[model samples]
Target chain A: MPKAPAGTLYRGREGMWSWVAHRITGVLVFFFLFAHVLDTALIRVSPTSYDKVIGTYKNPIVNVMEVGLVAAVVYHALNGIRIMLIDFWEKGPRYQKQMLYVELALFVILVVPDAYFSLEHTVRTIFGST
Target chain B: MTATVDGAGRPVIEAPRSRAPRPGRARARSNFELYAWVFMRVSGLALIVLVFGHLFIMNVLDGGVQRINWGFVAGRYASPFWRLWDLTMLLLAELHGTNGLRTVINDYAERPQSRFWLKMMLYTSAFLVVTLGTLVIFTFDPNISG
Candidate 1:
């Protein structure tokens, strides 16, 4: 009776993918934080190790990656706060889409500066102070 | 919870046996709610393990927060083993957080349009993050200026 594939419908569409992404980003941020904590712990191991860890952060590619991490944190944090509002305040689900858009707009606004600052710092760290 | 009767006097009933409308076209609770419920539970459990295991390995073990370095990462990436480990972590963690947030989205946002747009933004941002994150991890460069 249906024309499309099985996963194609009200069941497996835009909403579903978004749900998947949120969880994925959360997991990502968590892992990054874990690695970050461990990497920072390198200080006690030896100053050289610490420096190496610091040095890794200086890579341009890594700098770009940090931006991705920042985006994840920003988006997840914003959407997450939205979620809290719904759960605790009983916000209506009718506004879910609007809230999602606002959350995303805020995400871009927040992330650009955060990433810029991080990249600026990384560049400085790598090439020496400006 | 109202019912009607015809002139012939047969009582018209509402609320199907499954508490949903009818088979293949139930108007009950939108779509795939049962699956979403299951997703939340499964992803939540996986997150507990993946998240906590990561924390223990990073902050609690070894020299703790101080030993990480360039060579260390380079060393890890040197082996296919660490690469796979990292890639798996990347995929699973992102999925977990995104799923958790989706549940949140459904619960809140009273207006249908608001919910739709909010989720739209959420999905867009999530896609960008996941795409960029994967790229960075896989194509990481240890030496830029050198």
Candidate 2:
């Protein structure tokens, strides 16, 4: 196959990058859900086992990872809407780039507050309150 | 317009404009893929609500994960509303993720054998998760002593 030229409109632009981000975040969230369901299942074994496992989630490292997980879910959710619009709405294809910008703006708007709330206890645990 | 002469003086035949099968014809193809496409969008809208609600409650509210424990689990499960909410979320999220991974596998796994095995594994995991989760939700005994 012949090498394609660089800087194509669709190849390296917002559309392509958003698609890549959506797929990556989606897979991350899916795998996390698998583990999450299993962990929650531990409650059926015994409360002691459940609490012991869940307690590990409270530590600083996993707390940060929780924030990351939430971020991934948020991004995937927002972009999934964008994808629906691009499919269902008549003008959505024309304005996909604009929609992506809207999606990103909404992502930051939602995730920042979520991260703050999610990490507040961890932050307090790591560093004393003022 | 059915036929035109090419540069080589050979005739090019056009396919029938209406490719729909005639009445009484056996239709070999179904709208499975079309339904799958629509399912993704519909389930995605539902999951946005279910998943974000779950994230808000479990990860962002009232000291977040720090306060989650077996007692917290029991308290939430005590209510029928929360139990149904969790059950719906679990089923929808698992199915949505399974379909999404199926698409990814179809896209990337070029080898037929690899694709078949990957999808088999994906389906098995999905089945296990759905069954285990449903059982746990229904069979949870909050009063058990260990």
Candidate 3:
């Protein structure tokens, strides 16, 4: 007999980590976006001040935070898309595991390069290369 | 698009009969509903992967936290590749999430007008974000132009 994976909900369709993660990321992205809007709007106050504020965003730590921000937005968006498709299924409930595999593949394809570009850009700029 | 019957073509959106069917057939067995049911499952499954992979990478990867900035963003967006990557992610997420929410609204909202206006607001918001986000990603200038 196949052994069950740890952290299995013992009762649920698909992964519970995904569901909780989706909801949390959705809320987090929304809140962060609101703050981002406020920060961005600061440009209206004056360019230099705004740029200075924007300068703060250049900090690697802040950039790392953005990785989190982007991740949240990405996850929420992808899962939400997945959920939408499932809702359209003729028999989605029957093929959930297969769908899970598909979604995981899609996720990997999207995030890896996202993180890579983020790092590449940071490294290039820190070393003073375009 | 229109469905053709006999020698005539009729719009699918147009009713076969304006008044609809008898009480027993009001909710006829339908593939329309079946499609929507399937859409939710498929989208849900996609969301699971898109959402979790995003989390693990951002929150759990190298340094486990703390390593980002404008230069980081600028470096990536400087390339057309990252720009496209971002654009795809943005479009997919906005469309998927909003569409998912749209399904929820359709399921819950009873009144036609209520549904219409709610959807109006939701779509409006979604469109605004998609447009603005795309613009920001493409037109982004790290050098600050006045």
Candidate 4:
């Protein structure tokens, strides 16, 4: 058997990178939903359980994690659209790389403001100012 | 999308190689890919609305997370409106993400055994979550015994 190359994951063109990112983000979002549904289901047990669970999410660490979730979600959604276009549009496959660039651009644009707001909220909540 | 053998007896130019399933796997109907492809697009568009609306309602509007409590949840689910909304979002998002992961696994997993097991685990967990979530949404009882 041939030995695998080092940095194999990093060695990819734009489309490959986007494919990797989409898969990673997709997995992250899936796990997030898993946790989210479990937590939300706490409501069925009792409101107290639900509120207490949600209360745990107000800390600094969890708040930062939320920002990361936001980033993952933003990228996944944008790249998902890119994938859709590539599959559906007649001209899409030919310009897959260009579409990836556009997706990345939009990802940065949306995630930056979202991260900012998420952090701002985190700070306020941590300080008990809000 | 035909393959031809070279002078050395190696098959050449398997043009449909990318779309073909791994060896030993049953070939899917050609339209399956097309349907899965279309499902992603349609479900994705639906999720944008359902998910964003959920985020906005839960985290941004009317005093955000602080305002979230049993009462808040009960109030929302008290109406059929929020129940349907949450239910739709839950089902669509789960199915869409699961299908996307299925494609990822099919594309990347080198071993057929690995692919089969991975998808088995995925479908099992997805079923558990979706079922539990749906039941919770529909059968939630606001009153609890002390």
Candidate 5:
């Protein structure tokens, strides 16, 4: 058996890295969902309690984190479509590299405006504009 | 088995690789994995719409999270449409996330015991979150005093 091969389609390439990012972001989003459910459950406890907990989310730091969360979700959503196409579409695997580039382009196009809108309040808060 | 002489005059044994089973001879098994695969794609398509709409309404519109309060939540849950929307999003997102985490655990957890326990924990949390979220959506009292 040969000790090593010249190259591979997945190893250290766009496919592998995108898969890695998907897992990381998926985990991040899942954990956030768990906490979000708990916090939302506080509404049943009392309006005061729910508002108190939600108030923490209005802080500049947390707002920035929300931007990160949005970025993660957006990437996951777009890449998820890419993955489905790879599985279902006949020519998807043949052009997976091209699809990944398209996915990234769409991700940027979607997330830029989302990040700006999500962080606008944070910016205003930090710069004493509001 | 057939033997042939190589270039060095050594006898080479022929090893026949296992052939794929014929259609009727194929081993029977549950289609759980196949269903899970299909579910991921279907639920994912729905989630793209549900979750994006949710994020847009909650975090991007009307001054974003800064304006969200109990009143806003109450106002939303007052409508059956928003309640159903939230309920559907909650269920699908949780199930999708739980399945994703399950795949992650299966991939990374090297030991059987650790894998079992990790999945157990994941399922337990998923159950709790889904139950709690669903209950909150349905039983939410928008007019509660105090």
Candidate 6:
């Protein structure tokens, strides 16, 4: 008989979710870094080109995506510290679930305010025109 | 080992289940993985401060993104302190994120060919971005007007 379909590893536990989120956020941050570098480099070609590229970022779509970027950075940073603890601290693996909870709680506290600030800016930028 | 012939006439050695090695400690290799792990932690800690400060200055302070123009970038790049700061952030973030994805690809891609190709692509892109970014940081000139 064929083996059963592979179950999702992320469904296992808090640790699994943390692992999944770390990878997801890592990719997100990587892509952002790529674009950021490319756009910032436009300054070498010409200031007009640089301004034009960055000017596009003021649009509502890019504004929303900025929030996603912030979320990814926040989660990755938190989980990165957790991973370090797990690697170095003898008791870290044992209390990983508790650590994950703390990470999540902190994620919420940090992200909510950041989201508010980002959305507030975006809204103000989009609708604040005379 | 029991030998069997398939329809394709290929011999297969069927080792008994009892011979399977149980998962336990990983065999030691070079200290590369250890160093990579430590780099991720150290770079990540530094990135938290560098990245957030960058975001705050660019997007929150003063007039925010609206204030970012050619002149602003030119002025910032003129300062050696900001130049060094940005260069460090660029290198640390690129290396840390690249290593993180390397771990992800290793875990998810079971096929050897897939793993090799994916890593090749990842590394190439990482290299290109780092090179281009570094060049931009050091070579940027404010006097080059359109």
Please report the interface RMSD of model 2 to 1 decimal.
Answer: 2.0
Which structure is stronger by DockQ: 1 or 2?
2
Candidate 1 stretches with Cα past 4 Å from truth are A1-14, A121-130, B1-146
* Model 6 chain A worst lDDT run, 10 consecutive residues: A1-10
Error of 5 at B105 (Å): 1.1
TM-scores for all predictions: 0.43, 0.86, 0.47, 0.78, 0.85, 0.82
Candidate 1: CAPRI quality band: incorrect
Question: Candidate 3 at residue B17, lDDT?
Answer: 58
What are the per-residue Cα lDDT tens digits for candidate 4 across B40-67?
A: 8899989988886776666556645556
The interface root-mean-square deviations, each candidate in sequence, come to 11.4, 2.0, 9.1, 2.6, 3.0, 2.9
Candidate topping DockQ: 2
> Model 3 chain B — which ten-residue stretch has the worst lDDT?
B63-72
Residue A58 shift from truth in candidate 2, angstroms: 0.6
| Two-chain DockQ for each candidate model | 0.06, 0.56, 0.09, 0.38, 0.44, 0.46
| Candidates sorted on TM-score, descending | 2, 5, 6, 4, 3, 1
lDDT of 2 at B123: 98
| Prediction 5 TM-score vs. true | 0.85
Candidate scoring better on lDDT of 1 and 4: 4
Worst 10 residues of 5 chain A by lDDT: A1-10
Cα deviation at B42, candidate 3, in Å, is 7.2
Residue-level lDDT of model 4, residues A7-122, one tens digit each, is 56565788788878888988899988999999999988877778889986666688677768878887888877788788779999999888888887887987676666556666
Q: Residue B85 deviation, candidate 4, in Å?
A: 1.2
Error of 3 at A80 (Å): 8.6
Of the candidates shown, which would achieve the greatest TM-score relative to the real structure?
Answer: 2
| Per-residue alpha-carbon lDDT of candidate 3 for residues A47-112, written as tens digits (9 for 90 to 100) | 565556766655777766766676666666666666655655777666656777787787778767
